[model samples]
Target: MPFKASGRATDYRAIDRFDGGAGWIAHPEETMQRASHVLRASGGEADGGAWVVDPVNADGVDDLLAEFGDVRGVVVLMDRHARDAAAVADRHDVPVYVPSFVDPDVDAQTQPLGGTLPDSDYEVVRTVDWPGWDEAALSDGETLVVGDAVGTTEYFRAGGERVGVHPLLRVKPPRALRQFRPERILTGHGEGVLTDATRALQDALDGARRNAPEVWLNGLKALV
Candidate 1:
């Protein structure tokens, strides 16, 4: 099977619903040339049921929903990653949560995320807070979900060599997303870092701060 831009084959696997009624599902395939993931965190009696974060449009969504529960809401972590959020939201009849900087493009239920996640246990930390651009990290205590703010694709290409941060933000130099200090990180453009996630994030932040030549070159490659 052909892999997505992350250079990894599709990995749509069943989410493990925890005893607390919270779990997650990953959309194996990439649409619009990017990897995507979803978090199934329940809100409460007020909310219909479980909610999703940064969902990608794929065939497995319906099946996952059926297996899990109702998807009451969707969250988009970055402006550039709103590709399939609307479709997924509409399919499940849920609202789409996004930062004010994001443009959903598609016609669906969209609402600006006022510095907080909808109703999930996860909390968002703004990593890229530039004048015109913004990106954040959503953490559910154990797992951290990120957008283009970090990546693992480039590293996968060099035979599992040391992976680095996404190149584009190297120019501005990204701040360390150490607020959450999660053990695992799920990204929107890579296979994800499950081991030493905090250390890996720090290393990537260091590389971005120095504006490493390779990092810049790789960021350029992302454009073409």
Candidate 2:
């Protein structure tokens, strides 16, 4: 079954809820299995305000945001993942933020993101910057949020990876991500890795090339 986007989600499943953050998959049954996240500013000026990332609009998404506080902004980490970002940002009356290195082809107003996420400790890490592929990751030392370059989805993993490099990138995994040792990794697809995330990430990067053949086979099976 090829991946297909669904209409506005009627229901969503919440996941990765921590002290100051939470995540949800709006279209849980969709093959793409895209997930969105909200991270609240812990102690900064933006305290209580939360940032939404790669959102896919759902019926009660606003209620989920209310749990953390006000919605500050909507962030798009992958150029191709414009998803419901603009619509969500408009609904929240906030700006849509795209990484400074990314020139998304979406038809919406966007703010260039660089350095740290405004009002939060999350620092933007440029993960991929090739001609057609531009992606970014965010981390505040503890929780790591990635999009596209890596994921926990069935199509993204091989035999026993808690997380794995995106199948297309398996042969040349993003080295920029090797620097962090996050306690938990939230992705744009599938569920997050909440335990032993550091080792899971390291294994994914270190074994990405070596496991390419298996990943390819897994991806093929997923498509069928």
Best by TM-score: 2
What is the C-alpha lDDT profile of model 2 across 94-206, one tens digit per residue? 88998988766655678899888987889999999778999999998988999898888888887888899998898778889999999999999999989899999999998
lDDT of 2: 0.87
Model 2 bad stretches (over 4 Å) = 42-47
Task: Please write out the lDDT profile of model 1 over residues 52-159, one tens digit for every residue.
Answer: 666655544566555445676777887666666787788778788877766545567777776556656777777787666678777777777777777666522222
In model 2, residue pairs whose N, Cα or C atoms come closer than 3 Å (at least 3 residues apart or on different chains), thus clashing, are none
Q: What are the TM-scores, per candidate, against the unseen true structure?
A: 0.74, 0.95
Note the residue pairs that clash in candidate 1: none
Highest lDDT, which number? 2
Model 2 poorest ten-residue lDDT run: 41-50
User: Model 1, which residues run further than 4 Å from truth?
Assistant: 1-33, 43-48, 155-163, 209-211, 218-224
